[model samples]
Target: MKIPKIDKTILVHLALFAVALIYGANYTIAKEVMPLYISPSATILMRVLGAAILFWILVGKKRLILSNKREKIILLLSAIFGVVVNQLLFFEGLARTTPINAALIMTTTPLLVLMVSAITGGEKFTFFKIIGISLGLLGAAMLIGSKTVSDSSLPFSFVFDFNLGDLLILLNAVSYAIYLVIAKPLLKKYSALSISKWMFTLALPFVLPFGFSDLGTTNFEQIPTEIYVGLGYIVLFTTFLTYLLNAWALKSVSSSVVGIYIYLQPVLATFIAVALDKDSLTPTKLIWAACIFLGVFLVSRK
Candidate 1:
């Protein structure tokens, strides 16, 4: 008797699906814990530190060694874009903005990745890509209308306004896009666990300064159990599992395929949010979702 072997392509798709599922649910789960049970920055600190320890324990020291200065530099920069700026801005932004907005804005990542790759000479630009980018930006702007946290009644307004959190999430998308491009070569050379652990370890110094004070302020005992559960999800599933899965998938597929999966988050997030009563779906949200999906489809199209 013997166990049957699984297909690598199936495994990659499963990994990507798991990543999208974790992240889509994370939009609301993480939002529930931040700026209330714990500050956003402190949450980042916890997430990075916890994932780093887990990666180290899981991967061991053998794969952690680097062969060259260039790899070290790339890891450092990846830590900045991938861990520090990416996590910091996203958590902080989610603390202040709606989960739906975060989900919608994040649909731009595949387009951003394409643009970054083109600028870096890794890919060529085309008119269709330009149109896709424009559509994504338009959808984002529509979602950011003059609706404040207090203005819950105006769920789908189209008036122009700025939400700092939405803007930060946008920047987070850009940072993550840069990380994807910079870390592609590294992923091919190193085990995903090894790269992930090192990136989180290097991200510590930069993350600590921002999150340190908030870390001390969180009274863990007083927080509710659900918040802790949310925290654990962010630390374990969203941070560790998702990164490992993405890195594994990257080894088997193009980064563009990886980026395309981001479109799943909004759809999944919306369902989770609506089901949990954490958020609602409106006509405008549906319309924008369609626009975003179309844009991402064009960007990922050959």
Candidate 2:
């Protein structure tokens, strides 16, 4: 029997929701492995390698060959911005900054994406999208509580007294936003799995040098089972699955829509933490969630 087709819009939204949920858990899940069992460089090495291997295996010999060098260039840039810069900066930045600061800075990604897309002529700015991005950013601030800024994160006093680590995190957001915009054109011509697989594969070589020594020095036998489980989750679900989901969503939705869904990460992270008893549920959080929902709805409107 043939499987009935799912609506592309429904499928796209569902895929994005799954990506956000996976990322929400990843914030906590990844911590269980890094700085203890695996260094950030080594951890990223594992993420790229594991995801690369899985993607290659999933694609097998049926991989689509890009016929033009322009496609290769686009894919390479996507890999660098999406994986190399995005992951490495995040790890380094998070180490120097508190989660609250990182979360707030990262929430600016939607705005960055919108601005870049408009400037590049890839997207037309809309009133609803602007309001949506603003609302989502506000909701995120409310949920993460914007008051707790760490001094250590401030390395640069030249611009708004921003710290070095905070700058890196902001740059990471910018890089990923660029990746989404540049990669969107490719999505129109390739399967999400194929594009994702190639992006990770291309990213592997650039990332390998940074992580090799770290991975080589790690003591495997002494690492606990739980940490390994967390590592596996990062590689499989967070790295592999989320990328695929986002890519698939891109095939049907604009990059702005994909970017706006990031506002849900903190809201979902809060609820997940509550479920795990790592955090408490409060009325203020409920209000923030409503704002995020409204913002996402407005921004995602076609």
Candidate 3:
């Protein structure tokens, strides 16, 4: 069957939009399942394994070649940074922080990637990009501030007042930025699905220990069936489908455009949080959302 021609830009944007929506909803989904059936490590492991299996099934008989020792080494390292470490930090951070904070901090990944690229001579740092990144940070700060002010019912004491969840999400952003930079060169040689498969397979070993430990603490028999179903959804949609679509989008569109989509994540996440989880959509959130969106636009614009 012949494939129909599609506008690459439109397809990329659409895919990115879908990814943002799935990612946004994931915050609540993960929160619900993470505490019951899985630990951070286990959740990460399931994601990688599930995604890899799906990729392998789709790729069929076309053998993905590693080429040489150097390529294999690079792939290994890419898996370590991109899949293993990045996911480990992300899930653990999610466990500590609220989804809103996590989503907000994740907006920094693009700026961080740009900085890494500039320092490595992969890309030049432009003034506009700097301004854009600053805008993103300002937006995130506004959102954080709004969240802080709105939740006045809680105690003001330092120990009890602050949410550790946001900090964890920030770590995921940093790790993800590092992964993007490290994985860029490899993408030139391998297809995104191929790269994803190898990375996840290699990451499996590293993540397994954590997954097993989390399982030990939980009573598997006592957990509700819905929690497993939620886990399945996360693995299928958030982990597997989202990653594949993102990889395809990256291949088809400019990285700057792809980066801009990060802003969409928090917006979608907030809506999902409100609609499904019954989280408040406060004025403070709106303010922060504006700041973040402005920052993303500035950073990613030509």
Candidate 4:
């Protein structure tokens, strides 16, 4: 039997969008459950552990081997940026800001990734890319500005309050971009699953301190069952499955294409929030969504 040539570009983008959809559900679910069961650090710890376990199971023993010291170091660095720091910032940011704000801020990840890539010589700098990034930034500004202006219930003070959440999300984007840059070198040495597994393993130690502390503060018996269920979903779908798909996509496509898929996340998050959390679907969100998608399309076009 012969296998047909797969369009890796399409596959990567689609996988990323699918991950965004899963993550959309997570924003509502995680927010509700995370505060009830555990602190942000603990939540991240469990997620990393669960994702690692799943990756181990998928890869099995024979294929799990690391080829060299460089591979090991790369994996460690990837874990530091992608899992440990990125997730810590993201959860903390989520705790600080509205989910809508978090979502809107996350749309900037691709632009940041492109910039980082260009700076590092992973990708060439181009005038079109700059325009695309500007459009994305404008979209984000429009989204946030419109939201603040239209929602009378929102405290005017919030606009002035330094948004630590937005800052954390921005930090996550930078950390994730760094991880992507580091991973590119290691991907040549190891399979994506191997790299992912090692990264998770390294991240596990970093997460343990927070997990144990959070456990000490919370009463195990008093925690609601829904929290466990939500945690499980985040571990299985968002962390494990999403990473696998993302790695597969990255193997096949250019980083720019992979980055474009991030723009879809906020749109998916907004819709999911409306359907599940009783959040309003505003005209501002619609307009911002259009801007973001159009900008991403322009940037990603060949």
Best by TM-score: 1
lDDT of each: 0.87, 0.78, 0.73, 0.75
Per-residue alpha-carbon lDDT of candidate 3 for residues 1-302, written as tens digits (9 for 90 to 100): 99999987778788999988888888878988885567777778778888888878977556678778888887888788777877888888787767776777788777777776787787786788888777767665444333444247753211224445565566667667766676666676679888887778888888888787765676778778988888898899998888788777767664555666777787777778777863665555555566666666666767
Enumerate residue pairs that collide in model 1: none
Tens digits of per-residue lDDT for model 2, 8-89: 8888898899988887777666655777778888988889999999998998767678879998899999999999999998
lDDT for model 1, on a 0 to 1 scale?
A: 0.87
Model 2: lDDT equals 0.78
Locate the minimum summed-lDDT window of 10 residues in model 4: 154-163
Tell me the TM-score of model 4: 0.85
State every prediction's TM-score relative to the real structure. Answer: 0.94, 0.80, 0.85, 0.85
Query: Which tens-of-lDDT digit does each residue in 1-302 have in candidate 4?
Result: 99898776666667888988987777777787667667887788789988988888877774556678877677788899989998998888787666666777777777778788888877775778778888877776655444434356743311333566667877887788777777876665568888788788889998888777885776768778887788789899989988787777777766666666677777778778877763665555566667766666666766
lDDT of prediction 4: 0.75
Could you tell me the lDDT of residue 60 within candidate 2? 76
The alpha-carbon deviation from the true structure for residue 225 of candidate 1, after best TM-score superposition, in angstroms, is 1.7
lDDT of 1 by residue, 1-302 (tens): 99999999999998998898999999999988988789998999999999999988998876577889999899999999999999999998898888888998898899889988999999997888888877877777666654433346765455567789988988899999999998999999888888988999999889999989999988989999889888999999999999999988888888888888888888899889889999887777677767777888777777
- Best-performing candidate as measured by lDDT: 1
lDDT (C-alpha) at residue 289 in model 2: 55
